[model samples]
Target: MENYLNALLTDVMLKEEEIGDICDKACEILLNEPNMVNVPSPVLICGDIHGQYYDLLTIFKINGTPKSRKYIFLGDYVDRGANGLECFCLLLVYKIMYPSNIFLIRGNHESKDLTKIYGFYDEVAKKYGNSRVWRYCCDVFECLINACLVNGRIFCVHGGLSPSLLDIDEINRIYRLNKLPDNHFVNDLMWSDPDELNPGFSKNSRGAGYTFGSEVTKKFLEINNLTMLVRSHQLAFTGYQMHFKEKCAVTVWSAPNYCYRCGNLASVLRVDENDITGKNFLIFKDTPQKPSSVGLPGYFL
Candidate 1:
């Protein structure tokens, strides 16, 4: 797999410029992530796959195989996991091989600084002896950052909607053609957190990342006319949990033994929606196993 990955990585690196609209490429990956959803189709939503390669394999084994059921991976595809490149390759392969069925969204880790701080940068360096794979992935990551609209009532993102994004179309208009600047609105959209936001309304916490309050979510929904927000970022003691259960918002944490020692069960959401308006949930329990890699010192944490 290493040799194959090396070769594939080389090819991608060479063609990076030719890909045209890399951000569009990312959105293409996102929109199609839920392709398995036929008319009146069900969408299987997975969360925070933080580089747990084997656990992802286990997910395929336990859940319906990607060949059968449609899947929507809710970002955070790299970092924390031992084989960030491998996990990424698998996703890209799925997108290329099963273009219609598999999908990927940009997670917080997809950023340059985060990847350099976490395992991905080091993992690539160790595997390829250079920054080739890392560079290529950065290109791909920028493209898949955000995905949305699950069951018309629900708005899906790797994290929550930011208070700054007043209009949903404003988000849609953020085309892939523009060079995404650091600390720009697009960057905040993918990396922001909802946990540390003030209860009423406020900018995200600097240390806690971009936190959003229930009111922000509520207002966003009302303005956009959405019924729910389905996101993943925080680790729940249970595999999954509902926030403001009455408001139709839910969080699914799918990384088992999250952060390597947290004991929280990993989870995924099965939207039992027959159509856009319908929304329901089925939580998947974590498959017992230790993470392949933890916060290894000097390399990643």
Candidate 2:
């Protein structure tokens, strides 16, 4: 697997039967992916890599990996930094070596009680002393893919607008079994947030979803004919954040100096296959040293 992903990019740690055969082949490729997933335009979306594994290897060393482009990953790969299980088993070994160019959704700390109160369940029971590889990576994060849409007119998600989501086939008829749920619509598409001076919903002070606005993101992109709404749970010193006027939403945040003391600044959002309103916004920072085989102790929610 590319020398086990280059020995987990140099801080090796993957032999609990190879993370249970990479969580049984990434839960059989996230169970035939559904709960909303379409992806097309010259991809590369990314956001929140809370595990900061070398800033996820400096986002493939400034956007150019996964064999030369194509990604999605709006999710929080895992709790706090210090290689959250090697940044989620090197993104499930690049989604089992590029399953149609890798995509993954489910954020809000990929639950199971927020990785046992953040820190990926004690960094997987302190590096596999047990927890059966964190219960096969929480059954592959309950078969991920909660939202994504790209070429049909962008709408990826990690969180934001979800009053039972009115369309996108109601996010492909939800029902993402096990863990994650303290409120509906798959915990508001993984914990909503986006109130640029409230023009609609409210509540979320992290007390569980709902903060939405901008006319509820322009009425959920005019009832799903969509135009834009990419997401990533809060925190944007300059990494990313745009709302209502930027035509509804955008929040990418590839985790720069976030919990390492929120000096924030990190992003990603390439798009532009045939000009899906052509986009770009690489930005980066953080990584001035913090890898002497990281000794753990970083936290964020």
Write down the lDDT of every candidate, Cα atoms only: 0.63, 0.80
Error of 1 at 299 (Å): 18
Encode model 1's per-residue lDDT on 1-301: one tens digit a residue.
2333344333333222322333334445554333112222477778888877666767776876556777778788888777566567666665654555655766778778899998889887765557765787787775663665665556677776665676766766566446766556566656566643365445565542367667667777888787777778777778776765355577777888775677777777776645543235444554544434332333443
lDDT of 2 by residue, 65-170 (tens): 7776889888988888867778888988888888778788989898778898988888777765568888888888888888888888788889877777677786
Give lDDT: candidate 1, residue 178. Answer: 64
Q: What is the lDDT of residue 209 in candidate 2?
A: 81
Off by over 4 Å in 2: 1-12, 15-20, 23-25, 37-85, 90-103, 106-167, 170-220, 224-228, 232-237, 244-247, 257-301
TM-scores, each model vs. reference: 0.78, 0.34
Off by over 4 Å in 1: 1-40, 181-183, 195-197, 207-209, 275-301
